[model samples]
Target chain A: MVTSAAPRHAAPPVHAGPARMTATPPPIPTLLDSDVVRPAPPASRAIKAQVENFSFFYSTVQALADVSLPFRERAITALIGPSGCGKTTLLRCFNRMHDLYPGNRYVGRILLHPDNLNIVAREVDPISLRMRISMVFQKPNPFPKSIFENVAYGLRLRGIRSRSELEGRIQVALEDAALWGEVKDRLRKPAYDLSGGQQQRLCIARALANEPEVLLLDEPTSALDPIATSRIEDLIVELKERVTIAIVTHNMQQAARISDYTAFMYLGKLIEYGATAEVFQNPKCKETEDYVTGRFG
Target chain B: MSTILSDNPVSGGIAGSRNGGLLPPLRSRSLLGRLAERFIESGLLLAAAFSVLITGGIVFVLVSESLPFFRHVSAREFLTDRLWTPMFADPHHGIMPLVAGTLTTTAVALLVAMPVGTLIAVWLSEFAPSRLREVLKPALELLAAVPTVVYGYFAVDFVTPALQAFIPDLPTFNMLGPGIVMGVMIIPYVSSLSEDAIRAVPMLLREGSYALGAGKFTTAMRVVYPAAFSGIASAYVLAISRAVGETMIVAIAAGQQPNLSFNPLDPAATITAFIVQVSLGDLPHGSIGYQSIFAAGVTLFVMTLGFNIIGAVMRRRYRQAY
Candidate 1:
């Protein structure tokens, strides 16, 4: 069976026929200029989280350092970094959960709608901004509620009062999260009764109920076992067709496995941003190369 | 975060190494330590037992006092009878009027509390930011801890007059004044309990609602409220119990007369208030007068206990299973 080779940013082989062994290559630059691969740029600004000069600070501590990048619309963009490198912090900024904690400060523009550029101002209404960008945390956090109610939660908030309408929506959202078949018969059952994986899926279903335009996943599969992680990975693909996604993953394999684009950050700075294969194989920046190649955290 | 590795000579390390190897090893039991530990454990056990025992004793006493009334007067007549003339020589001590009065006050209090308390909870939990929420939560709960007598005093001195200005013929001791005051007293019970429940809802749920383009108020009212309903329902029950069992406020603000009227503007009496009226200062024990107070006490106890049971069961059935 022919499979599409791993998407761009994969390092092309450096062979001996090119005299690469004899001629010690200079410390190679990482970034592959866009012009090298495709001649002309696309017409539309097609991306979900367009961060322009985005810098975030928690009180006096700087978290994200002037990170400028765009997450392709409906295409998964993985922010890969080690612990405390600000991937989660950056992800939280999209949905504004950081706003809940005091002393969270930021200076930048994060654009959800590339078409209209609605969030150019730093003082955008976070509630409305957050509504367009749904988030799933690292741990599965289904409310202490029934499975049906968990999925129905966001839909109900939208004033979908009719039981039939709610049920229909709950079914669709659960199905979208790939959790319906297992929980379909037990909608009234408590959410905690489900397996860890199922609970994560139910949380995902709850998020989906609101029909968000962008989904932010902060190490969503970190706590799940491999099988559940695989299921979530598959669901991410299925979800992408409808809404944009920004995923923060520490696992390099996860980034390689699922994302269309990958951004590598180190010490709270976006070191490299490009197609996943290009970023992984031929990181233009020494920092990105060192980080991605396992030479440095 | 860390332990120090000191080069102490004998006593500090292994009880002697840091202190020139002078002291003998101490066993796990020292006379003082053993005694203190035992005392502490027993104290905790006794404290916990007393907590349970106190609750049990109250239930036992209420039932013991109520049993004779139930035996002398059939449960059906006590529950269904229309008149409440406990002091009357002919003995027309029907409890229907008292129950009706209790229900009227409870319903009106609920009507007042559910909306205002829920709104305050929503505002405190969802709308208000950290600085304001910290300031407001305690201030709101302070409403609950205010002495009941003080609330009663206000009901008579402040609320009754204010109410009369609107309703010209309002009675000085009317259910409306007490019911409204009771609602105010119980607001903290509803607001704080509900605010906690709403706040407990995972941030993810709120985020999902927000992402759907629904407003904050919409998300809180629709999403968080229903998710926290079981807890909120429990809170409501708690508030109702508080309203129904309140004695001083209703006794002073609402009239002592048990004239079976459902109208809020008219004077009516609740079971607890009637107990206060009957049990005031000099009521001879073993007499029916004394027994009537016990009977009223039993009724109040039963109603409050029922609310607690319902609240607990509802919470258990509809808990945050996940």
Candidate 2:
């Protein structure tokens, strides 16, 4: 299942030209300087999930306000903004993670495609919905279990009792995560015995074990060193070919380098949504331009 | 100072100070401050060392006193022969009966405490709402605050009578009543410590489980329990130690006859109860009968020490697993 290794620090191939020069020093782009309109994702790709006028409240405080966005099929959508800009909040709403806490309310629907199920509906079970939508958290959080068992956890949850089937699926998931080679000899070792980067990959392998249709990543490398972060970035890029991916990241260059689409949120509002190249190089929204150009965040 | 500043890039900027000294030469501590610091350090050290000294002294006393008793009774008889009638005209000093009694009562207490305490901990840590947990924890701890003497009476006066209704053959001073009461008394120690351990597990782990679609029960059993295993193991050990060394409940409720029987329905005397029974009477200070209590004390000490070693090893193993 291995593909040719992408170059380290590779920018999205579609947008790898002069347009991507905004990352380096240039005359600081002012809010009024750019007039380029937001370029939408091409109509050829199908929408995998859509957030329709979604708003969220933690008791009385609204963390997300009337946010609407689309996750394109088998594509990486990056959510970027300042801290508490509701990027993570928006990503969590996809799998009904807020349901874990009381007094957290969702006012609009997150419609999953194919089945078109309203994931946030009260009648819908968050546990069952989470089966099809898995998540990798900000910190690497492999269970206090053997590496093999960590990968097999979600499979066992789905009642995969056959030992051979579990081993096969776990192998594929670990291979897909690029971790099987490093950990193959000692699958019975504890997950924490691995380094931080490997632990995060084990988490990804754990999420992948479910073969979920959608995968949510919340700052999956914020805790790692640059080298480990780059490895996870490479893995995320490869993962988008199989599962619809949405990521929340503070690293703007990272968002630019990996994401197919970019959504900029500010103060619980979606400031802009478009192709990653347009968002970084030529944002339609002034806040998006100011934030993306490192003028302010 | 100039040499130091020239060698360090960060400190070079401060080299132009009027005095050649770097940062005012860090004001020397006053004599009074130095004295107070020394006093506090030694005072804290003494406080810590005080407990260790007391424990060492107790072990010395138990060993010295028990040496006389072993000279009077052969070690093989003390270990093997079941009869333990030290005050009889023809006394039999076999310690087997007391050891058997202690083990039986402790086993019964653990049978009741381990499972019940663990379930209570899981409920408090994973299932209970925060407000409920806040109110419930301190209230549950009140179980431990109730004096052991009260638990002893409750075992004899209330529990034994209640059990008698169903099992008419159970004697009034049967070990079963006191064992269950001791377990109830120890519930707080186990549940409270286990709850703290389970609660201390980082939220990230639970989120990982939930993201995998595991329900609250599954998350608690599969993820939280194993993650908190070391802490829970220590809690269990503490409960075992508490039950083994427990004095009042068994002394009052379980009959003080050193009967070598494992049956819970039979009256028995644990090591603690035997000690209490002997210490109450006036035997010559250095006599074998009086010295037997020290021998019993040593056995109890050994049992608790073994348990603590097992707990420490378990805690290290699970901590390393993570």
Candidate 3:
């Protein structure tokens, strides 16, 4: 659909012919200059998951209003906005994380294709769905069990009780999260004994053990130190080769460094979304530009 | 710093000391004020020591009173004999029957209270909604505030009659009746303390479990329960101690007979009940019968003290730092 409201950042690809340059690309209007109008790019990109005209409410308060975006497969999509802008809310909708509470209502459809399941459908069981689309929390929350048992929890839920199989899978998941070397000698030790960075890595390993199709991270490094944050950022980059990732982060540089696509939300609305490089360097909406340029949140 | 303190009482002592690199001196105070401060400090210390002094006094009394009874009757016979007829014409003051009676009633109370109390705690902390929890928690705790004599009456009038229908030969006053009523009395302690401990576990842990695809039952039983195990165990120990020290219910409903039997339906007299029996009757204050209560009191104190210590150690050992 050729809606004129395509994110100003994702302008239609420049025509190859030099003759079209003379027409002058439609000028973006400054706040002072209101007469200019520009056509936005078509929202017809191939997508792994499509949030179609979706809105959400917590009791009577609307948290997201008719947000629509494409989550591409095998790539990192970062949801960035100021606090209470509904970025985390949109990320949680991907895995139905809000199902934990009562009176949290989802309206419209979040159609996840290939699997062809609308995640918000009443018939869909949240427990089984969570196995396919797992989540990581803001703070590191490893179980009080041993590191081995913490990593084995998800696998055990699926009934993988054989010793050799559990050991092999635990090793592989820990290695994938880049934590096996530090914790290999202490697999039987309680998880709380690990350093903060190591604990966060252990949580990542726990999620990896399940091999979910999509991984949702909700500000996974907010409680971490700088060194731990960088390590988690690197892990997120490496993980996208196997699993689709949807992350909610307030760190713009981290998003610019790691994500392929970025969706900027404001006041529960998708203000702009496109390739991260383009959205950062050249935002289409005035509000998007202001947020990326650090003028205002 | 001295000048600042004398000039400005509004500036906290900390700020003056921090900036000046010297503590505000108290020596400049009037002699009378200094003396008053010293007196106050000692008064507070004495108040703290008063509890220790009382504990020591109880030990001294028990040991001195019990020493005379042991002189008349050997410690070996008093401890090993199955019969405990201290007031009889040919008295054979064995402590076995009273000890057995205390254990039987305590075991019955724990058997009835542990599972039911823990289940109620789990339901309150994990399953109940906030609105329901607000109403139910205080209502359940109100059971503990009911006087023990009232529980005794209820046990005799209500519980024994109920049991008589099924057993057909239930006694009027038996260990089972008081034990069941005592279990009901102890339920609130177990449930309230366990609920507090379970609720103390961080919500982050529950969210972690849910994020890992665990259902609510798995989250509650596997994760939350283990995290709160020490607290729940301590609650159990405290509840058991409360049951052992319980007096009025057992004295009224568990009979005055000192039978050395494990049969809960049979009439028995717990240590507390025997102490009550001896204290209420007319006997010379210094007689062997009167002195026997002190020995029993010492045993009861040691048992309850052991339980409280165990509870304290468990609380320390399993405390989660987070």
Candidate 4:
């Protein structure tokens, strides 16, 4: 699956022989190399959104500095980085989540394709932009409402008032989030009654109810147990057939397992971007290689 | 263990050596320290018990004083009788008129308080800038600090005349004036408490709504409001109790006559107002008029208690709901 997703490039050599027999190890990559070589995505895939030289600030402190990356249509793009490396900051910028606070500013353009709307433009309404690009938070944040109402919330925001319409859409969203089978009989129960994993799926169902074009997940399974995390991973992999996905995760194995493409960020900059297999096995930049190999964060 | 011995030389040398190099006992060694701890615990327990004792004392007095009044007037007449003319030459002992007056004023006050207070709370919690919130919160609390007597006069002298300009038949002494003024007085309580509740709701929930394309008003109404419903409900109950027990405002503005009418424009005396009137008059100690106030007092206590019980049940239900 990994090799199939990689774009055409000079494949890195694999060490088939035992490393101990060589009596010496390969040279470790150093951070002095400045150039970042981002292997292009396969030609068959189209770009869903392009973030161009985007910089973000929380008051006077810059969180993301002149970072550019692309999310391919109907594909999973995972962002992996250490804490405070601006991966989550860049993910939040896709839906303009920063607009909720005061003294936060966006510089440069994040252009949504097809119609080519710049999401970060001051004149663009965050509400409308958010409607097109939905987000699942780092922690599950289901509203203090019923299981049914939790999924129905976003649908209701779009002015879908008919009972039948709401029910049908909510069922579809819940099913898509892989939670309908467990919760079908208890639609009226409070959302808080659900276990942690189920509640996280309910949040995903809530986001999916809007039928957003792009879905952003910010460590959506970090708070879940292993079984729940695996279930969510399977659901995310399944979901990419319909919606474009951008995820931020600290887990390197998770990025390799689930993502079609991966972007490694460090110190508020994009260190490397390529197909998941290429980035993991053949990182183009020293920092990216160091981060991917767990040499240093 | 060695680090601990090094850190504390006295305990390592004396206490440890006394225990044959074992760590010293976890319990305090000083008798004075143990005694001081016991003293503090007893002092705290006594402080807690004192409030409970006072409540028991008040209940005992109300029941005891009410027994004498109930002896003179049958329970049936005291409850069903419409006239409460205790001071009349041929006095009637019915409590219905006073109950009606209390209910009418309370309903009017709640009508003015609940929605207005909730709106103010939502604005402060969700939309107000930090500087404006800091300034407005203290100013709103200042309204609560104003003397009830001053509000009473304000209701009678300012509010009544201003209301009369619109409705010419409105009486100078009517429940409407005091009811509105009392609602204004209780606004600070409701808004402050409700704002605290709304603000206490986790920001994560609000972000969930906003992430789904919800505007500020939508998120405030659907998400923040329901999340804070229990706290807001408690604020409503407190405002209801305050309006029910308010004495000066109703006594000064609403006339002292007992009229069994629910109309806010009607001149009537609430239970609290009647209690104040009877307390001021030179009625004999054991006279029926003097005993009548106890009956009114007990009735007020039961009504407020019912509201509080209902508020508690609702709070529990909502606290679990989320």
What C-alpha lDDT do the candidate models reach, one value each? 0.77, 0.87, 0.84, 0.87
lDDT of 2 by residue, A1-297 (tens): 001222234433443444344454434453322322223446547889999999999999999999888899978999999989999998888888888889999999899999899988999999998999999999899899999999999999999999999999999999999999999999999998999999999999999999999999998988887778877887898888899999998877677677889999999999999888677776888798878766776
Q: Write the per-residue lDDT of candidate 2 for residues B9-32, one digit (tens) a residue.
A: 555335446456554533345789
Better of 1 and 4 by lDDT: 4
Name the candidate that leads on TM-score: 2
Pitting candidate 2 against candidate 3, the one with the higher DockQ is 2
What does candidate 3's lDDT look like per residue over A227-283, in tens digits? Answer: 777778778878987888899987676666567888999999999988775576557
Pairs with steric clashes in candidate 4:
none
Q: DockQ: which candidate is best? A: 2
- Compared with the true structure, model 2 gives a TM-score of 0.91
After superposing the true interface residues, what Cα RMSD does each candidate give? 3.7, 1.7, 1.1, 1.9
Evaluating just chain A, the predictions reach TM-scores of 0.83, 0.89, 0.85, 0.86
Return the candidate ranking by TM-score, descending. 2, 4, 3, 1
Which parts of model 1 are misplaced by more than 4 Å? A1-50, A73-75, A95-134, A143-176, A186-193, A203-214, A238-244, A281-286, A293-296, B1-36, B59-76, B281-283
Location of the lowest summed lDDT over 10 successive residues in candidate 2 chain A: A1-10
lDDT of 4: 0.87
Error of 1 at B67 (Å): 5.6
